[model samples]
Target: MTYSLSDFGSYWAGGEVLCVTEGAPREIAFTRDARFTYDPRGDFAVNAAYVQYFVPAQAVDAPPVLLVHGGGMAGSCWETTPDGRPGWLHRLLDAGRVVHVVDLPERGRAGFAPGHLPGEPILRSMQEAWTLFRFGPAEGFADRTPFAHQQFPVDALEAFARRFVPRWQGTAHLHLAAFLAVLDRTGPALVICHSQGSETAFDAVATNPNRITGLIALEPSAFPDDPAALETCPLVIVQGDHLDSADHWRTRADRWATLADELPDARLIDTAHEVASGGSHMLMMDRHSDQVLEATLGHVRV
Candidate 1:
Protein backbone atom coordinates (compact mmCIF):
# COMPACT_ATOMS: atom_id res chain seq x y z
CA MET A 1 0.00 0.00 0.00
CA THR A 2 2.94 2.32 -0.41
CA TYR A 3 3.29 2.73 -4.12
CA SER A 4 4.69 5.98 -5.45
CA LEU A 5 6.75 6.24 -8.53
CA SER A 6 4.01 8.12 -10.24
CA ASP A 7 1.70 5.94 -8.20
CA PHE A 8 3.64 3.04 -9.56
CA GLY A 9 3.31 4.37 -13.06
CA SER A 10 -0.35 5.03 -12.68
CA TYR A 11 -1.00 1.65 -11.18
CA TRP A 12 0.99 0.10 -13.96
CA ALA A 13 -0.87 2.21 -16.46
CA GLY A 14 -4.28 1.68 -14.97
CA GLY A 15 -5.00 -1.86 -16.05
CA GLU A 16 -4.19 -3.00 -12.54
CA VAL A 17 -0.79 -4.20 -13.64
CA LEU A 18 -0.95 -7.35 -15.69
CA CYS A 19 1.50 -7.87 -18.46
CA VAL A 20 2.11 -11.13 -20.34
CA THR A 21 2.70 -11.47 -24.03
CA GLU A 22 2.68 -15.19 -24.60
CA GLY A 23 3.65 -18.40 -22.86
CA ALA A 24 3.14 -22.17 -22.83
CA PRO A 25 5.49 -23.04 -25.65
CA ARG A 26 7.97 -25.73 -24.77
CA GLU A 27 5.80 -28.57 -25.89
CA ILE A 28 8.65 -30.88 -24.97
CA ALA A 29 11.51 -30.82 -27.44
CA PHE A 30 15.21 -30.85 -26.83
CA THR A 31 18.55 -31.78 -28.33
CA ARG A 32 19.26 -28.22 -29.44
CA ASP A 33 16.75 -25.46 -30.15
CA ALA A 34 18.33 -22.16 -29.17
CA ARG A 35 16.92 -18.70 -29.74
CA PHE A 36 17.96 -15.75 -27.61
CA THR A 37 16.84 -13.26 -30.16
CA TYR A 38 16.01 -9.64 -29.16
CA ASP A 39 15.23 -6.20 -30.46
CA PRO A 40 11.64 -6.88 -31.28
CA ARG A 41 11.09 -3.38 -32.58
CA GLY A 42 12.41 -2.17 -29.30
CA ASP A 43 10.40 0.36 -27.36
CA PHE A 44 11.35 -1.43 -24.30
CA ALA A 45 10.62 -4.62 -26.22
CA VAL A 46 8.02 -7.06 -24.79
CA ASN A 47 5.98 -8.53 -27.53
CA ALA A 48 7.33 -11.93 -26.73
CA ALA A 49 10.70 -10.97 -28.12
CA TYR A 50 12.70 -14.18 -27.50
CA VAL A 51 14.70 -16.37 -25.11
CA GLN A 52 14.23 -20.11 -25.38
CA TYR A 53 16.58 -22.98 -25.77
CA PHE A 54 16.97 -26.70 -25.07
CA VAL A 55 20.30 -27.90 -26.16
CA PRO A 56 21.30 -31.51 -25.56
CA ALA A 57 22.24 -34.54 -27.57
CA GLN A 58 25.52 -35.17 -25.98
CA ALA A 59 28.98 -34.27 -27.13
CA VAL A 60 30.95 -32.70 -24.37
CA ASP A 61 33.03 -29.54 -23.96
CA ALA A 62 30.77 -28.43 -21.19
CA PRO A 63 30.57 -24.95 -19.57
CA PRO A 64 27.47 -22.98 -20.56
CA VAL A 65 24.46 -23.59 -18.36
CA LEU A 66 22.35 -20.59 -17.41
CA LEU A 67 18.71 -21.49 -16.79
CA VAL A 68 17.67 -18.70 -14.34
CA HIS A 69 13.90 -18.55 -14.16
CA GLY A 70 11.28 -18.64 -11.38
CA GLY A 71 8.82 -15.94 -10.30
CA GLY A 72 5.49 -16.57 -11.99
CA MET A 73 7.38 -18.62 -14.65
CA ALA A 74 8.86 -18.38 -18.11
CA GLY A 75 11.67 -19.73 -20.27
CA SER A 76 9.11 -22.45 -20.07
CA CYS A 77 10.59 -23.18 -16.67
CA TRP A 78 13.52 -24.92 -18.30
CA GLU A 79 11.35 -26.40 -20.97
CA THR A 80 9.11 -28.30 -18.57
CA THR A 81 8.75 -32.04 -18.95
CA PRO A 82 8.43 -35.13 -16.83
CA ASP A 83 6.47 -38.17 -18.06
CA GLY A 84 6.63 -36.62 -21.51
CA ARG A 85 10.44 -36.56 -21.47
CA PRO A 86 13.32 -34.07 -21.92
CA GLY A 87 13.14 -31.48 -19.16
CA TRP A 88 15.79 -29.59 -17.22
CA LEU A 89 16.70 -28.51 -20.68
CA HIS A 90 17.23 -32.09 -21.69
CA ARG A 91 19.12 -32.74 -18.50
CA LEU A 92 21.60 -30.02 -19.29
CA LEU A 93 21.59 -31.14 -22.86
CA ASP A 94 22.15 -34.82 -22.10
CA ALA A 95 25.09 -33.76 -19.92
CA GLY A 96 27.12 -32.22 -22.60
CA ARG A 97 25.96 -29.15 -20.67
CA VAL A 98 25.54 -25.98 -22.69
CA VAL A 99 22.12 -24.61 -22.05
CA HIS A 100 21.03 -21.01 -21.46
CA VAL A 101 17.44 -20.14 -20.87
CA VAL A 102 16.28 -16.71 -19.78
CA ASP A 103 12.98 -14.93 -20.17
CA LEU A 104 13.38 -12.83 -17.09
CA PRO A 105 12.28 -9.20 -16.52
CA GLU A 106 8.57 -9.94 -16.53
CA ARG A 107 7.66 -13.29 -18.05
CA GLY A 108 8.41 -14.93 -21.41
CA ARG A 109 8.81 -13.63 -24.91
CA ALA A 110 10.04 -10.66 -22.90
CA GLY A 111 8.40 -7.58 -24.24
CA PHE A 112 6.27 -5.11 -22.32
CA ALA A 113 6.59 -1.37 -22.11
CA PRO A 114 4.10 0.76 -23.86
CA GLY A 115 2.29 2.19 -20.93
CA HIS A 116 3.25 -1.03 -19.09
CA LEU A 117 1.20 -3.69 -17.28
CA PRO A 118 1.86 -6.75 -19.37
CA GLY A 119 1.69 -9.20 -16.47
CA GLU A 120 0.87 -9.51 -12.78
CA PRO A 121 -2.86 -9.42 -13.46
CA ILE A 122 -5.24 -10.65 -10.79
CA LEU A 123 -8.96 -10.97 -10.14
CA ARG A 124 -10.48 -14.06 -8.58
CA SER A 125 -13.58 -13.16 -6.63
CA MET A 126 -14.98 -10.10 -8.33
CA GLN A 127 -17.38 -12.52 -9.99
CA GLU A 128 -14.45 -13.69 -12.10
CA ALA A 129 -14.30 -12.01 -15.44
CA TRP A 130 -14.57 -15.41 -16.99
CA THR A 131 -11.99 -16.51 -14.49
CA LEU A 132 -9.85 -13.63 -15.59
CA PHE A 133 -9.84 -14.49 -19.25
CA ARG A 134 -9.42 -18.19 -18.50
CA PHE A 135 -6.47 -17.61 -16.22
CA GLY A 136 -4.10 -16.34 -18.81
CA PRO A 137 -1.11 -14.11 -18.12
CA ALA A 138 0.83 -16.78 -16.29
CA GLU A 139 -2.20 -18.35 -14.66
CA GLY A 140 -3.41 -14.89 -13.79
CA PHE A 141 -0.71 -13.82 -11.39
CA ALA A 142 -0.51 -17.41 -10.21
CA ASP A 143 -3.73 -17.51 -8.25
CA ARG A 144 -2.62 -16.29 -4.88
CA THR A 145 -6.35 -16.34 -4.22
CA PRO A 146 -6.80 -13.65 -6.86
CA PHE A 147 -3.40 -12.00 -6.91
CA ALA A 148 -2.51 -9.61 -4.15
CA HIS A 149 1.14 -8.78 -4.30
CA GLN A 150 2.25 -6.88 -7.35
CA GLN A 151 5.33 -4.69 -7.72
CA PHE A 152 7.59 -2.83 -10.15
CA PRO A 153 8.02 0.79 -9.29
CA VAL A 154 11.56 0.86 -8.20
CA ASP A 155 11.64 3.39 -10.96
CA ALA A 156 10.07 0.80 -13.19
CA LEU A 157 13.29 -1.11 -12.91
CA GLU A 158 15.11 1.99 -13.97
CA ALA A 159 12.66 2.51 -16.72
CA PHE A 160 13.26 -1.03 -17.80
CA ALA A 161 16.99 -0.57 -18.00
CA ARG A 162 16.79 2.57 -20.06
CA ARG A 163 14.87 0.69 -22.70
CA PHE A 164 16.73 -2.60 -22.63
CA VAL A 165 20.29 -1.99 -21.56
CA PRO A 166 22.34 -0.95 -24.51
CA ARG A 167 24.07 2.04 -23.00
CA TRP A 168 21.51 2.85 -20.43
CA GLN A 169 22.72 4.38 -17.23
CA GLY A 170 21.17 4.54 -13.78
CA THR A 171 18.99 1.76 -12.17
CA ALA A 172 22.11 0.72 -10.44
CA HIS A 173 23.89 1.32 -13.66
CA LEU A 174 21.45 -0.76 -15.62
CA HIS A 175 21.87 -3.57 -13.16
CA LEU A 176 25.56 -3.36 -13.48
CA ALA A 177 25.28 -3.20 -17.20
CA ALA A 178 22.98 -6.16 -17.46
CA PHE A 179 25.37 -7.94 -15.22
CA LEU A 180 28.26 -7.27 -17.49
CA ALA A 181 26.35 -8.23 -20.55
CA VAL A 182 25.27 -11.58 -19.20
CA LEU A 183 28.72 -12.43 -17.98
CA ASP A 184 30.44 -11.20 -21.09
CA ARG A 185 28.39 -13.47 -23.27
CA THR A 186 27.81 -16.31 -20.86
CA GLY A 187 31.06 -16.88 -19.07
CA PRO A 188 32.86 -19.96 -17.71
CA ALA A 189 29.27 -21.24 -17.12
CA LEU A 190 27.20 -23.23 -14.66
CA VAL A 191 24.43 -21.16 -13.03
CA ILE A 192 20.96 -22.56 -12.43
CA CYS A 193 18.74 -20.10 -10.63
CA HIS A 194 15.06 -20.33 -10.03
CA SER A 195 12.63 -18.34 -7.85
CA GLN A 196 13.32 -14.67 -8.29
CA GLY A 197 15.95 -15.47 -10.84
CA SER A 198 17.97 -16.30 -7.78
CA GLU A 199 18.34 -12.61 -7.39
CA THR A 200 19.69 -11.94 -10.82
CA ALA A 201 21.71 -15.11 -10.84
CA PHE A 202 23.28 -14.07 -7.58
CA ASP A 203 24.08 -10.67 -8.91
CA ALA A 204 25.55 -12.18 -12.04
CA VAL A 205 27.97 -14.40 -10.17
CA ALA A 206 28.58 -11.87 -7.46
CA THR A 207 29.54 -9.09 -9.80
CA ASN A 208 31.70 -11.26 -12.05
CA PRO A 209 33.96 -13.52 -10.06
CA ASN A 210 35.93 -14.16 -13.17
CA ARG A 211 32.63 -15.28 -14.73
CA ILE A 212 31.52 -18.15 -12.52
CA THR A 213 32.55 -21.77 -12.71
CA GLY A 214 29.79 -22.85 -10.36
CA LEU A 215 26.43 -22.00 -8.75
CA ILE A 216 23.06 -23.81 -8.57
CA ALA A 217 20.77 -21.77 -6.34
CA LEU A 218 17.31 -23.13 -7.13
CA GLU A 219 15.01 -21.36 -4.71
CA PRO A 220 16.91 -18.18 -4.05
CA SER A 221 15.07 -14.85 -4.02
CA ALA A 222 18.05 -12.58 -3.62
CA PHE A 223 17.51 -10.81 -0.32
CA PRO A 224 20.73 -8.87 -0.40
CA ASP A 225 21.66 -6.68 2.52
CA ASP A 226 25.31 -7.06 1.72
CA PRO A 227 25.57 -10.85 1.66
CA ALA A 228 28.91 -10.22 0.00
CA ALA A 229 27.42 -11.16 -3.36
CA LEU A 230 26.29 -14.47 -1.91
CA GLU A 231 29.53 -14.87 0.02
CA THR A 232 31.38 -14.99 -3.26
CA CYS A 233 30.08 -17.91 -5.35
CA PRO A 234 30.41 -21.73 -5.38
CA LEU A 235 26.88 -21.88 -3.90
CA VAL A 236 24.26 -24.65 -3.95
CA ILE A 237 21.43 -23.61 -1.64
CA VAL A 238 18.24 -25.31 -2.85
CA GLN A 239 15.15 -24.80 -0.67
CA GLY A 240 11.50 -25.87 -0.52
CA ASP A 241 10.54 -27.07 2.92
CA HIS A 242 7.39 -25.17 2.20
CA LEU A 243 9.56 -22.18 1.39
CA ASP A 244 11.03 -23.00 4.80
CA SER A 245 7.97 -21.74 6.66
CA ALA A 246 8.17 -18.35 5.05
CA ASP A 247 9.51 -16.03 7.71
CA HIS A 248 10.87 -14.14 4.79
CA TRP A 249 11.70 -17.56 3.40
CA ARG A 250 13.33 -18.53 6.62
CA THR A 251 15.23 -15.30 6.77
CA ARG A 252 16.70 -15.83 3.36
CA ALA A 253 17.48 -19.45 4.07
CA ASP A 254 19.09 -18.49 7.31
CA ARG A 255 21.03 -15.83 5.54
CA TRP A 256 22.14 -18.30 2.89
CA ALA A 257 23.07 -20.87 5.47
CA THR A 258 24.95 -18.20 7.36
CA LEU A 259 26.82 -17.27 4.28
CA ALA A 260 27.47 -20.96 3.71
CA ASP A 261 29.07 -21.18 7.12
CA GLU A 262 31.64 -18.55 6.44
CA LEU A 263 32.32 -19.80 2.94
CA PRO A 264 34.51 -22.82 2.80
CA ASP A 265 33.66 -22.67 -0.88
CA ALA A 266 29.95 -22.39 0.03
CA ARG A 267 27.24 -25.05 -0.39
CA LEU A 268 23.77 -25.68 1.06
CA ILE A 269 21.55 -28.19 -0.65
CA ASP A 270 18.40 -28.15 1.49
CA THR A 271 15.94 -29.75 -0.93
CA ALA A 272 13.39 -29.75 1.87
CA HIS A 273 12.75 -33.49 1.52
CA GLU A 274 12.97 -33.39 -2.23
CA VAL A 275 10.37 -30.68 -2.20
CA ALA A 276 7.98 -32.25 0.31
CA SER A 277 5.10 -33.39 -1.92
CA GLY A 278 3.92 -29.92 -2.91
CA GLY A 279 6.75 -27.59 -3.93
CA SER A 280 4.54 -25.11 -5.61
CA HIS A 281 6.70 -22.14 -6.05
CA MET A 282 6.35 -23.70 -9.41
CA LEU A 283 8.72 -26.42 -8.14
CA MET A 284 11.03 -25.69 -11.01
CA MET A 285 8.08 -26.86 -13.08
CA ASP A 286 6.80 -29.62 -10.84
CA ARG A 287 6.95 -33.38 -10.58
CA HIS A 288 9.98 -32.67 -8.47
CA SER A 289 11.62 -31.45 -11.67
CA ASP A 290 13.74 -34.54 -11.98
CA GLN A 291 14.70 -34.17 -8.39
CA VAL A 292 15.64 -30.61 -9.14
CA LEU A 293 17.50 -31.78 -12.20
CA GLU A 294 19.36 -34.50 -10.39
CA ALA A 295 20.41 -32.08 -7.71
CA THR A 296 21.46 -29.63 -10.36
CA LEU A 297 23.62 -32.01 -12.34
CA GLY A 298 25.28 -33.38 -9.26
CA HIS A 299 26.43 -29.92 -8.30
CA VAL A 300 27.29 -28.74 -11.78
CA ARG A 301 29.45 -31.77 -12.45
CA VAL A 302 31.45 -31.22 -9.29
Candidate 2:
Protein backbone atom coordinates (compact mmCIF):
# COMPACT_ATOMS: atom_id res chain seq x y z
CA MET A 1 0.00 0.00 0.00
CA THR A 2 2.25 2.75 -1.29
CA TYR A 3 0.91 6.29 -0.82
CA SER A 4 1.69 9.37 -2.83
CA LEU A 5 2.01 12.86 -1.39
CA SER A 6 -1.57 13.63 -2.49
CA ASP A 7 -2.84 10.50 -0.75
CA PHE A 8 -1.34 11.69 2.52
CA GLY A 9 -2.97 15.11 2.07
CA SER A 10 -6.35 13.51 1.61
CA TYR A 11 -5.79 11.24 4.60
CA TRP A 12 -4.73 14.16 6.78
CA ALA A 13 -7.75 16.18 5.68
CA GLY A 14 -10.16 13.54 7.01
CA GLY A 15 -8.08 12.02 9.81
CA GLU A 16 -9.48 12.24 13.32
CA VAL A 17 -7.57 14.37 15.79
CA LEU A 18 -6.67 12.63 19.05
CA CYS A 19 -5.33 14.05 22.32
CA VAL A 20 -2.11 12.24 23.23
CA THR A 21 -0.82 12.21 26.82
CA GLU A 22 2.83 12.45 27.86
CA GLY A 23 4.28 11.93 31.38
CA ALA A 24 5.61 9.25 33.71
CA PRO A 25 3.32 6.52 35.09
CA ARG A 26 3.02 8.34 38.45
CA GLU A 27 1.31 11.28 36.77
CA ILE A 28 -0.17 10.82 33.32
CA ALA A 29 -1.05 14.27 32.01
CA PHE A 30 -3.03 14.92 28.84
CA THR A 31 -2.05 17.49 26.30
CA ARG A 32 -5.30 19.41 26.83
CA ASP A 33 -4.37 21.65 23.91
CA ALA A 34 -2.43 19.88 21.18
CA ARG A 35 -2.11 20.40 17.41
CA PHE A 36 -1.23 18.05 14.52
CA THR A 37 0.00 18.68 10.98
CA TYR A 38 1.35 16.61 8.08
CA ASP A 39 4.42 17.74 6.14
CA PRO A 40 5.45 15.30 3.39
CA ARG A 41 8.81 16.94 2.80
CA GLY A 42 9.66 17.42 6.43
CA ASP A 43 10.73 14.79 8.99
CA PHE A 44 8.55 11.77 8.27
CA ALA A 45 5.92 14.16 6.67
CA VAL A 46 3.54 11.80 8.43
CA ASN A 47 4.11 14.80 10.74
CA ALA A 48 5.53 14.60 14.25
CA ALA A 49 3.34 15.60 17.24
CA TYR A 50 4.70 18.19 19.67
CA VAL A 51 3.91 18.17 23.43
CA GLN A 52 5.02 21.12 25.57
CA TYR A 53 5.49 21.12 29.36
CA PHE A 54 6.16 24.53 30.87
CA VAL A 55 8.63 24.29 33.77
CA PRO A 56 8.71 27.75 35.35
CA ALA A 57 12.27 28.28 36.50
CA GLN A 58 12.93 30.03 39.83
CA ALA A 59 15.12 32.40 37.91
CA VAL A 60 13.09 33.70 34.98
CA ASP A 61 16.16 33.66 32.75
CA ALA A 62 17.07 29.95 32.97
CA PRO A 63 17.50 28.12 29.65
CA PRO A 64 15.23 25.18 28.89
CA VAL A 65 16.22 21.54 28.21
CA LEU A 66 14.52 19.45 25.56
CA LEU A 67 14.06 15.79 26.63
CA VAL A 68 13.67 13.39 23.72
CA HIS A 69 12.89 9.68 24.02
CA GLY A 70 14.03 6.85 21.83
CA GLY A 71 12.04 4.80 19.30
CA GLY A 72 9.00 2.69 20.44
CA MET A 73 8.50 4.92 23.50
CA ALA A 74 7.04 8.40 23.88
CA GLY A 75 8.14 11.22 26.17
CA SER A 76 6.01 9.65 28.87
CA CYS A 77 8.48 6.79 29.22
CA TRP A 78 10.91 9.22 30.82
CA GLU A 79 8.43 9.96 33.58
CA THR A 80 6.80 6.52 33.99
CA THR A 81 7.26 5.11 37.50
CA PRO A 82 6.69 1.59 38.80
CA ASP A 83 5.21 3.02 42.01
CA GLY A 84 3.31 5.86 40.30
CA ARG A 85 5.37 8.91 41.25
CA PRO A 86 6.72 11.80 39.21
CA GLY A 87 9.81 10.62 37.33
CA TRP A 88 12.69 12.56 35.80
CA LEU A 89 10.40 15.38 34.70
CA HIS A 90 9.95 16.44 38.29
CA ARG A 91 13.62 15.89 39.00
CA LEU A 92 14.67 18.27 36.22
CA LEU A 93 11.95 20.73 37.21
CA ASP A 94 13.06 20.62 40.83
CA ALA A 95 16.58 21.44 39.72
CA GLY A 96 15.44 24.65 38.02
CA ARG A 97 15.61 23.42 34.41
CA VAL A 98 12.66 24.09 32.15
CA VAL A 99 11.86 20.89 30.24
CA HIS A 100 10.01 20.18 26.97
CA VAL A 101 9.22 16.62 25.86
CA VAL A 102 7.68 15.57 22.53
CA ASP A 103 5.99 12.57 20.88
CA LEU A 104 7.47 12.09 17.40
CA PRO A 105 4.86 11.29 14.75
CA GLU A 106 3.20 7.87 14.26
CA ARG A 107 3.77 6.67 17.83
CA GLY A 108 1.89 7.30 21.07
CA ARG A 109 -1.81 8.29 20.88
CA ALA A 110 -1.34 9.66 17.35
CA GLY A 111 -3.50 7.70 14.94
CA PHE A 112 -4.49 7.31 11.29
CA ALA A 113 -7.98 6.61 9.98
CA PRO A 114 -8.72 3.31 8.22
CA GLY A 115 -8.84 3.17 4.40
CA HIS A 116 -5.99 5.67 4.30
CA LEU A 117 -3.86 3.08 2.55
CA PRO A 118 -5.97 0.01 1.85
CA GLY A 119 -3.50 -2.32 0.22
CA GLU A 120 -1.15 -2.78 3.17
CA PRO A 121 -1.63 -5.52 5.74
CA ILE A 122 -3.51 -4.70 8.91
CA LEU A 123 -1.01 -5.60 11.59
CA ARG A 124 -1.94 -7.90 14.44
CA SER A 125 0.19 -5.86 16.82
CA MET A 126 1.69 -2.34 16.84
CA GLN A 127 5.06 -3.62 18.05
CA GLU A 128 5.25 -6.23 15.30
CA ALA A 129 4.03 -3.64 12.87
CA TRP A 130 6.59 -1.08 13.96
CA THR A 131 9.39 -3.59 13.67
CA LEU A 132 8.22 -4.70 10.25
CA PHE A 133 7.56 -1.20 8.96
CA ARG A 134 9.74 1.42 10.67
CA PHE A 135 13.47 1.87 10.89
CA GLY A 136 15.61 2.17 14.04
CA PRO A 137 15.67 -0.68 16.58
CA ALA A 138 15.36 -4.10 15.02
CA GLU A 139 12.65 -6.62 15.97
CA GLY A 140 14.98 -8.50 18.31
CA PHE A 141 15.42 -5.47 20.52
CA ALA A 142 11.67 -5.01 21.11
CA ASP A 143 10.22 -5.70 24.55
CA ARG A 144 7.83 -8.53 23.61
CA THR A 145 4.97 -7.78 26.00
CA PRO A 146 4.30 -4.30 24.60
CA PHE A 147 4.95 -5.22 20.97
CA ALA A 148 2.78 -8.32 21.06
CA HIS A 149 -0.29 -6.63 22.51
CA GLN A 150 -0.64 -3.46 20.41
CA GLN A 151 -2.04 -3.58 16.85
CA PHE A 152 -1.78 -1.18 13.88
CA PRO A 153 -2.74 -1.17 10.22
CA VAL A 154 -0.08 -1.70 7.58
CA ASP A 155 -1.09 1.46 5.68
CA ALA A 156 -0.05 3.46 8.71
CA LEU A 157 3.28 1.75 8.25
CA GLU A 158 3.24 2.75 4.58
CA ALA A 159 2.50 6.34 5.52
CA PHE A 160 5.41 6.27 7.97
CA ALA A 161 7.82 4.70 5.50
CA ARG A 162 6.76 6.63 2.38
CA ARG A 163 6.53 10.00 4.07
CA PHE A 164 8.65 9.88 7.22
CA VAL A 165 11.55 7.45 6.75
CA PRO A 166 12.98 8.80 3.49
CA ARG A 167 13.48 12.33 4.76
CA TRP A 168 15.00 11.22 8.04
CA GLN A 169 18.77 10.85 7.74
CA GLY A 170 18.35 8.94 10.96
CA THR A 171 16.13 9.31 14.04
CA ALA A 172 18.45 12.15 15.18
CA HIS A 173 17.40 14.78 12.61
CA LEU A 174 13.71 14.32 13.25
CA HIS A 175 14.29 15.09 16.92
CA LEU A 176 16.84 17.84 16.21
CA ALA A 177 14.36 19.76 14.05
CA ALA A 178 11.67 19.39 16.69
CA PHE A 179 14.03 20.73 19.38
CA LEU A 180 15.40 23.44 17.08
CA ALA A 181 11.89 24.70 16.42
CA VAL A 182 11.30 24.92 20.14
CA LEU A 183 14.67 26.61 20.71
CA ASP A 184 13.94 29.17 17.97
CA ARG A 185 10.94 30.30 19.97
CA THR A 186 12.32 29.69 23.48
CA GLY A 187 16.13 30.24 23.33
CA PRO A 188 19.36 28.20 23.42
CA ALA A 189 18.86 25.12 25.64
CA LEU A 190 20.51 21.89 26.74
CA VAL A 191 19.46 18.59 25.12
CA ILE A 192 18.85 15.51 27.29
CA CYS A 193 18.31 12.52 25.05
CA HIS A 194 17.90 8.88 26.05
CA SER A 195 18.73 5.67 24.20
CA GLN A 196 18.41 6.40 20.51
CA GLY A 197 17.40 9.97 21.29
CA SER A 198 21.12 10.68 21.67
CA GLU A 199 21.47 10.18 17.93
CA THR A 200 19.19 13.15 17.39
CA ALA A 201 21.13 15.25 19.89
CA PHE A 202 24.36 14.39 18.12
CA ASP A 203 22.86 15.44 14.79
CA ALA A 204 21.54 18.71 16.26
CA VAL A 205 24.96 19.63 17.65
CA ALA A 206 26.67 18.62 14.43
CA THR A 207 24.26 20.45 12.16
CA ASN A 208 23.54 23.58 14.21
CA PRO A 209 26.97 23.91 15.82
CA ASN A 210 26.76 25.46 19.33
CA ARG A 211 23.01 25.99 19.37
CA ILE A 212 22.80 23.51 22.28
CA THR A 213 24.99 24.07 25.32
CA GLY A 214 25.40 20.42 26.40
CA LEU A 215 24.02 16.92 25.91
CA ILE A 216 23.33 14.18 28.49
CA ALA A 217 22.90 10.89 26.61
CA LEU A 218 21.65 7.94 28.65
CA GLU A 219 22.52 4.48 27.31
CA PRO A 220 23.21 5.87 23.87
CA SER A 221 23.05 3.35 21.02
CA ALA A 222 26.10 2.53 18.95
CA PHE A 223 27.09 4.94 16.19
CA PRO A 224 30.03 3.56 14.17
CA ASP A 225 29.85 6.12 11.43
CA ASP A 226 31.60 9.48 11.64
CA PRO A 227 32.14 10.10 15.35
CA ALA A 228 33.80 13.36 14.39
CA ALA A 229 30.37 14.87 13.72
CA LEU A 230 29.61 14.51 17.44
CA GLU A 231 32.92 16.05 18.57
CA THR A 232 31.66 19.65 18.54
CA CYS A 233 29.56 19.40 21.73
CA PRO A 234 30.39 18.39 25.30
CA LEU A 235 28.68 14.97 25.44
CA VAL A 236 28.22 12.65 28.40
CA ILE A 237 27.41 9.11 27.17
CA VAL A 238 26.06 7.01 30.08
CA GLN A 239 26.26 3.28 29.60
CA GLY A 240 24.76 0.74 31.98
CA ASP A 241 27.42 -1.87 32.75
CA HIS A 242 24.70 -4.39 33.44
CA LEU A 243 23.48 -4.11 29.85
CA ASP A 244 26.80 -4.89 28.16
CA SER A 245 30.24 -6.20 29.06
CA ALA A 246 33.41 -4.28 29.93
CA ASP A 247 34.59 -4.84 26.36
CA HIS A 248 31.50 -3.12 25.05
CA TRP A 249 32.09 -0.12 27.29
CA ARG A 250 35.78 -0.09 26.45
CA THR A 251 35.11 -0.09 22.72
CA ARG A 252 32.45 2.64 22.99
CA ALA A 253 34.63 4.74 25.31
CA ASP A 254 37.58 4.43 22.95
CA ARG A 255 35.43 5.49 20.03
CA TRP A 256 34.09 8.46 21.93
CA ALA A 257 37.58 9.40 23.02
CA THR A 258 38.80 9.10 19.45
CA LEU A 259 36.02 11.36 18.26
CA ALA A 260 36.76 13.85 21.05
CA ASP A 261 40.43 13.74 20.24
CA GLU A 262 39.74 14.78 16.67
CA LEU A 263 37.43 17.72 17.43
CA PRO A 264 39.23 19.29 20.44
CA ASP A 265 35.94 20.99 21.32
CA ALA A 266 34.33 17.66 22.30
CA ARG A 267 34.62 15.84 25.64
CA LEU A 268 33.42 12.34 26.52
CA ILE A 269 32.52 11.10 30.02
CA ASP A 270 31.95 7.36 29.99
CA THR A 271 29.73 6.47 32.94
CA ALA A 272 29.45 2.72 32.36
CA HIS A 273 30.99 1.78 35.70
CA GLU A 274 29.11 4.56 37.42
CA VAL A 275 25.81 2.98 36.32
CA ALA A 276 26.88 -0.64 36.78
CA SER A 277 24.24 -1.31 39.42
CA GLY A 278 21.44 -0.30 37.08
CA GLY A 279 19.86 -3.25 35.30
CA SER A 280 19.89 -2.41 31.61
CA HIS A 281 19.04 -0.07 28.77
CA MET A 282 16.40 1.99 30.60
CA LEU A 283 18.89 3.21 33.20
CA MET A 284 17.49 6.74 33.35
CA MET A 285 14.28 5.33 34.84
CA ASP A 286 15.90 2.55 36.83
CA ARG A 287 16.88 2.35 40.50
CA HIS A 288 20.09 4.28 39.80
CA SER A 289 18.29 7.33 38.41
CA ASP A 290 19.87 9.49 41.12
CA GLN A 291 23.33 8.49 40.03
CA VAL A 292 22.41 9.07 36.41
CA LEU A 293 20.94 12.44 37.32
CA GLU A 294 23.96 13.42 39.39
CA ALA A 295 26.36 12.41 36.64
CA THR A 296 24.23 14.23 34.08
CA LEU A 297 24.02 17.35 36.27
CA GLY A 298 27.78 17.33 36.79
CA HIS A 299 28.34 17.43 33.03
CA VAL A 300 25.50 19.71 31.88
CA ARG A 301 26.63 22.75 34.02
CA VAL A 302 23.06 23.95 34.41
**Lowest-lDDT window of 10 residues in candidate 2?**
5-14
TM-score versus the correct structure, for each prediction: 0.26, 0.59
Model 1: residues with Cα > 4 Å off, grouped in runs: 1-49, 57-66, 69-94, 98-100, 105-109, 118-191, 198-219, 222-250, 253-296, 299-302
* Residue 282 displacement in candidate 1 (angstroms): 23
Local accuracy of candidate 1 as per-residue lDDT tens digits, 1-302: 11111110000100123444544433333337855433223223222223443444444676777676654445664664423444677665655655667654434454334334333442123223213211112344334232222111221222222222211112223233443455566557777776556666666666676687778776566644456665546777665444433366567768778767766667676654543444433345445667766765666444
In the range 1-302, model 2's lDDT, one tens digit per residue, is 11112110101111223333432233333466754542222222334445556554362355677777765566676564433445676677666667776555443433322222224322234444344322123443344322221221222333322222211223344355655555565456777777666666676666675677777776565452566665656666665532233465456656656655676555454444443342344555555565667776776554
* lDDT of model 1 at position 236: 75
Q: How many backbone clashes does candidate 2 have?
A: 9
Give the TM-score comparing model 1 with the true structure, all chains together: 0.26
